[model samples]
Target: MTTRNIVHLDADRVYWTTEVTYDRFPARQLWALAAPIHELVIPARLRHAAGASRPGDLQHQLVTTFQRRLGNPVLSRLPGQTLLETTGRSSGLPRQTPIGGRRVGQEFWLVSEFGERSQYVRNIQADPRVRLRLHGRWLRGVAHLLPDDDARARLKSLPRLNSTAVQAFGTDLLTIRIDLD
Candidate 1:
């Protein structure tokens, strides 16, 4: 299993985590794990932090300030909005793929191609408890979700899989979300 380290930033602090077995995993599943958490926490965390001023508001402020100044930078460090990783399941090695393409603008928006048969997609459908990590010049954040409706909608809106990109490796393209982060 391949282990890929990722970073996440929330309203409070940053975190670092590893996505084990990424190379063998599929992209769709990775998105499913990440999309909902990104959609709900990111915005709420930002808003909660914005008005912070005192000790009680420090957590909110931290989240807000980080989102305002470091959100994009942190996101840019992600391998991609969608990622594949391996995990330990009762049946030997099970792949834990998280999908959800992200776009970084004034805020980060996540997208995905739903209904695609992939390990990452299936993982999300079966279980939404996933973790994310963000590494930065000086800080990092780790995030996860218990599962929620807001995340489901965000996943549903992901762009369809289509398009192509020609790079040094030659012609390579797949249905992916465009994320500025």
Candidate 2:
């Protein structure tokens, strides 16, 4: 193996196998190397698979897998994760979707990945009245779809990890602001 690869592997082994805490210098150095490794390993095509110019087959498969098999269940159980409840346009029944957002003052803001085509967005159009579960507490709110908002800037202001996913995978982004009660 190359010297660089050997060192990287050794660092990973030390980090995972040993009892070293993340606060230590060695552990911190290992963590610092993780970003570059992650970037290097994921090919550019795969990283930008969900762009508007790209045919969305790979993106569709990944998103479908996460939403059905992973995202829904995990978000439901997580305490601080946000769950949005909207009335189904067709069935007139309550439809709950796990979403990521930031709360500023009395307003909660999120961007829809599929813009107006998203099912939840359609539900919001039918009825602006909604409910949000934030920090393990359910609160009533009014949903407002902001077509004119700068989605890129808004995404930057939200949580980094979720925003990164949204930016990378989102094709047509539409911002939604909830006026919490």
Candidate 3:
């Protein structure tokens, strides 16, 4: 058995590969049956993850819980999903949170569904320096929590489907602007 992780630095892609060899006939037979099931189950769990799909339809506590558990991890790994990476306030570690946003000029804009109460929000407050994975490329930036910015109006400027989801499920909407360097 062998595994390979191919990282294309230029393309910013990670390819997960595994090769399994069964020596015995029974082992091969068992694996043949399991392989098909494996194919179906893996992608299914990934899809079940709110991050892989979208959790916009879910409500407050549910949204937060589901997203924290099932959203960010899968979403952050998606090919083109945007990820916000911040320094953990107390732990002093990098924390990546999947977010919905759009880039305008050199700035990346997003609305926080949880406002200042979100963990990432508090992280931003502690330290504004951050990284954003946009369309597969990592960009260094500084995060700004815009309290006065009209979040609803800001949503209108973002992607329609995501903005609609944010409008539908958001309780405390706050605008966040990341000035990219």
Candidate 4:
């Protein structure tokens, strides 16, 4: 596959264009796998090159878009993952976000990758009351955001795969504890 950017400049206008060419099967398969990463990296790099104040913000946006649009919706339906259902702060609707946490006695603990920037975290801030789907059962709980808690150390206690992501793309990591009933 080959990509070309053609720039045609005139006195009154500038035309910027991108052109892509690929072979029948092999190149198409390669591009299909690469497109997602390319979509994320190119914009992020462009933003960074243009001296954007927060480069991490681009990554956060990309991650959240993936989670909100695709990942969460798919994962929430699966019985295997833990899902936290928070009341939407603005819409007053239920928002279920797939999460990685552990249950200990009467409590459930997890870390928010974006802290209060996360929609569900913001929802929790507005209303501490929430419902968690644990082991295919919904349990009522009161959520608490622990800003002072060591989120890095707390991640160590959570699921490894999720904790790795939280550590990697997380801008403002926050620990959350839920008192389950």
Please count the clashing residue pairs in each candidate, in the order shown.
41, 0, 1, 0
Order of all candidates by lDDT, from best down to worst?
A: 4, 3, 2, 1
Q: Rank the candidates by TM-score, best first.
A: 4, 3, 2, 1
Assess the local accuracy of residue 1 in candidate 1 as a C-alpha lDDT between 0 and 100. Answer: 42
Q: Please report the candidate that would top TM-score against the real structure.
A: 4
Per-candidate Cα lDDT values, in order, are: 0.38, 0.77, 0.81, 0.87
Per-residue lDDT of candidate 2, residues 73-144 (tens digit):
887787777899999999999988889889999999999877886789999999999999998899999999
Q: Is candidate 1 or candidate 2 better by lDDT?
A: 2
Kindly report which residue stretches of model 4 are placed more than 4 angstroms away from their true locations once superposed. Answer: 6-17
Mind sharing the TM-score for model 3?
Answer: 0.67
After superposition, which runs of candidate 2 have C-alpha atoms over 4 Å from their true positions? 1-62
Model 1 lDDT, residue 2, Cα: 49
Write candidate 4's Cα lDDT for 1-181 as tens digits. Answer: 7878776878855455567799567888898777776667766765576576474677787899788778988998798778999999999999898999889899999999998889999999999999999998899999999999999999998889999988998999999999997
Pairs of residues at least 3 apart in sequence or in different chains that clash in candidate 3: 51-71
Please write out the lDDT profile of model 1 over residues 1-181, one tens digit for every residue. 4456576988986565645554545655776576555555554555566653333233333343444446535644466434333233334354533333443442223322222232333443454333332121211111222223343445444444411111111111123222222
Q: How far is 26's C-alpha from truth in model 4 (Å)?
A: 3.4
Worst 10 residues of 4 by lDDT: 46-55
TM-scores of all models?
0.24, 0.66, 0.67, 0.78
Q: What is the lDDT of candidate 3?
A: 0.81
